[model samples]
Target: MTRSTWRTRIGFILAAVGSAVGIGNIWRFPWLTAENGGAAFLTVYLLLVVGVGVPGLIGEFVIGRRSNRNPVGAFDELAGRWFRPLGAVALLASTVILSFYSVVGGWILRYTAASTTGAYFTAPQEYFAAIDYGLGAVGFHVLFLAMTVAIVYLGVERGIEVSTTVMVPGIVLLFGALAVWASTLPGAGGGYDFYLSLDVAYLRENLFSVLPAAAGQALFTLSVGAGTMLTYSSYLGEDRSLAADGTLIAVLNTAIGVLAGLVIFPLLFSLGVSPGQGGPGALFVSLAGAFAELPYSRLVGVVFFGVVLLAALSSAISILEVLVAYLVDEHGLSRERATLGTGGLFLVTGSIAALSPAVFALLADTLANVVLTAGLLGFLLFDGWVLGRLAREEYARGAGPIARLFELPWYYAIAVVLPVFLAFTLVTGVGGILGIGISTRGAAAVAVLGVGGAILALRRHGVPG
Candidate 1:
């Protein structure tokens, strides 16, 4: 049987942008920005996005298009079966992401409906706590999962491409309109100050502490290290300059995330709400409370949460697609069958997250970050050390001269420097999770020494650089 392929370059790019632009952009980016000193964190994040994230994205595109296989099969085909576990790690990241992601999507969907009905407006905090776990959460999760599975069942081009092409543009338009409207609100200037103002003192004092978050957010915002990019690129029918596509996706995703910040921060400040105060539930609790007090509360609530629902559903489609593609491409299951099977798996796993706040926190905060960092690290090492010269050739296949000029440096960065940087991030993230109390400098030193020793061992083992 023939494999599935994306119908057009624009379609593929739109789908990738849809995957990248998600709840992370809307909820997490602004929170991180507010917590880490706004413009200062944004500056470091943009640098990392360019320096680390884009190259990592293109690396996945190269591997996927080169092998034309799902993550596991791609590694099995390109690097032999011995490296398939690396691909499995990518698959694991996707599953871990979507399990909690779908539960969050369910929450967004509930908020979207509640906005019109004024269900949560009476007592937003209590309402959120009441519905955050147990049977209600599970039922809502199943509803969200059903919508996701239905789309994936329609196959790649018909379902994913078509849906994102519409959804991505809608996300931009709605959020853009919201930002414009938000700027006109009374006391909105304070929100913009909180969002865009530079805090050199805060940044200088906490640069090292913030670096880990900035790096992780760069990866999370771009949807790297999760196999979603690889699976999307595997459907490509032609070389359309992986470098160009990766850059466009990064820029669009970043723009949307920033725009979301514009909408979120101004509204919060206008209503005197503190950003990032409530953890992952911050968006639901704080924003819902904001909507409750505003004039035209119903309209604002519906539009805001509705846009969020669209963003959540679009991202859920991509994450779920990763495992579905694995089943179809590697196991020869029909698309419908594969989607159903994956949905069933998530039916149980996602319910666990929806039913337990602790499990949801574990998956979303600790497990998701560690797995995504580890997955991207594997892909970069494979591109730099394993694919090496061939990876560059793949990158250059349809790239213009301007794009091709960065090929050599891109290869070296991905091969050596990025792996070390990502290793330090992985270490710091694990330390944060385990309460290990390792200093950022200590983590950096350990990561560099570890990479150097690994390079020497690989050289002695006759592995190609």
Candidate 2:
């Protein structure tokens, strides 16, 4: 059987961008920005996106396009069965993320519908608290998962590429309009100042604390660590420059994130709602409350939450596709069967999350970051030591002269610098999750040791550094 591939380069790019631009940008980015030093956090985040995220993205693209297979099979085909476990980590990462992500998608779906009826306008916090976790949440999660499965079942070109082609542009247009309207809101200047103005002293004081959060968000927002990008790139039927495509995707994803902050902060400040308040409920509670106070509250709410729904669906589709692709490529399941089976699995897992607050928080806040970081760490190691020069060959296959010039630097960044950085973040992430305080020196030692062990293992596998 001939495998499905993207119909056009633009289709591939837009679909990839759709995966990248999601709740992470619309919901999490503003909250993280607010919790950190606003613009100071944004500055560091942009640097990391450029420095760490893009190179990591290209690495996934290389692995995917080179193998032209799903994550698990990509490893089996490229290296050997021993490395298949690395791919399984990615598969696990995708499963872990989507299991909880569907629940959040359900929340966005409910809000989108509720917005039209002004259901939550009267008391947004109370409304969210009521429906956040229960049978009601499970119903919405199933609805959202069904929508995602429908698309994935339709296959790649007919479903994902086509839908994102429309959805991505709609997201940009809606967000642009919302940002413009947010600018006109009374006292919006304060929001802009809060988001854009850097606090050098705050950054200096809390740089260590903020770094881990920002790094995790960078990985999450790019959709890099969970094999979504790898799965998406595996559909690429052409040899267009992975470097160029990766950079463009990163830039567009960052722009959408910044634009989300523009819309969210201004609205929050207009209502005098602190962005940091409500924690995970910040969007559903604070922002929903802000929408309630607007002149055309219902309409504003509908448009805002509708945009979120689209973003959520786009991302959910990508994650679901990871599992679906695994089944189809590795097990020879039909697309329909694979998607339905995957949906059934999430139906159970997502309902579990929707029903239990503790489980949802554990998956979303803690395990998601740790698993994604570890998954990306495995990918970079494979690309660096196992694939070695072949990774560069795939990277430079269709790259232009300008992109080709940075091949060596890009390789080194992904091979040496990123693994070390990811190791540090992984340690910090685990420590933060377990409430075990790790000193800077301790974390650094762990990172170095982890990287050394990976290198030694690869060498023993007869892979040249």
Candidate 3:
């Protein structure tokens, strides 16, 4: 079977942006920002996105476009069987993310439909509590998974590229309109102050506490740590600047995320609702109540959730495509068989997540961040050590002079600095999740030791640097 490639450059960009601009941005970003000192969190997150996220993104892109293979095959072919497990880690990260991600997608789907009839307007909190877990959640998850499978079944160009080309623009345009309208709401200025006004003293005092959450959100929002970007880039047939494309995707995703905050914060503030109240349920519970009280309640609710649905679907498609591409490339399955098989697997996993709140929280809140961070750590290590100069060569390919200037610095950052930072974040993330106390020095020691051991192991395996 012949491999599929993106039909156009813009198609590729839109699809990549679609993958990045998803539930992570629309739902989770605001919730996280609110929970982690608002503007203080945003400040750390933006710095990390530029410093760590972009280089990490290009690492995946270089591996993907250079090999033109799924994550597994790319590693297997590029490095050796020794590195195949690294790729498998990325594949697992994708499966883990979309399992819970589909459940959230299902929620968005349900909310979008219910918004049409003002179903949740009467009692938003109670409605969410009732439907958050159970057979209804499972059914909706299946429905959302089915929609994703249909698109992947249609092949890359006709389905993902075409759909995201429309969806990305729609998300941006609709979000722009919502933001504009949100600015007009009375007391909306408070929302702007809370979100946009940085508290330097708070950040200085709480930088360590804020780093893990900000780093995780940065990875999550950029779609970097998972193989989603790698899988998407594997469909590229052209020689273009990976740095430029990766930067653009990150910028677009960040812009949309900030725009979502613009829409969400003001609406929450205007309604006298605290943004940080419900944790993961904040977006639905808080926003649903706000929509109900607003003029044209049903219309507002539908549009908001509908945009969320589109974002969710776009991201779910990229994640599902990772598995589909793996099956087709590595197992020699047809696209249709690969997609259906992947969908079947997710149906079981997503249903489990939906039916069990503990399972959902485990996947969404804890495991997703840890796995994505670890997965990107592996990619950067492989890029810096195993791929070495080949990685640099691939990065510089088709890059413009401006992009070329940063190639050496980018290489060192991905190879050394970013890996150390990711390892530290990963340690902090795991310790936080498991209720363990890890001092910053302890975490740094662990990160250095971990990276050093990996390097020695690669050298022992006769891997070239």
Q: For residues 1-465, could you state the per-residue lDDT of candidate 1 as single tens digits?
A: 688889988899989998999887887777678777778888888899989999999999988998999899998888677678878998899999898888888888889888887888877767888888788899889999999999999988889889888888888998888788788878789878877787889888887668877887888888899899999998886659999999999999999988987877787776666765556666777678767777889888888888788788788899898898889888999989999999999999999999899999888767887898889988988887777788888999989888999999899989899999999988887887778988868999989887777555434532353
Relative to the true structure, candidate 2 reaches a TM of: 0.96
lDDT of all predictions = 0.85, 0.88, 0.89
Candidate 3, residues 44-125, lDDT tens digits: the string is 9999999999999999999998888999999888877877888899888999999999999999999999998999988877
The TM-scores, one per candidate, come to: 0.94, 0.96, 0.97
Model 2 ranges with Cα > 4 A deviation: 293-296, 462-465
Question: Higher-lDDT candidate among 1 and 3?
Answer: 3
Candidate 2 residue-wise lDDT at 395: 90
| lDDT for model 3 | 0.89
The predictions' CA RMSDs to the true structure, in order, are 2.1, 1.6, 1.4
Compose the digit string of candidate 2's lDDT tens values, residues 359-428.
9988887788788889889999899988899999899898999999999999998889999999998998
Pairs in steric clash, model 3: none
Which candidate achieves the best lDDT against the true structure? 3
Q: What would you estimate as the lDDT of candidate 1?
A: 0.85
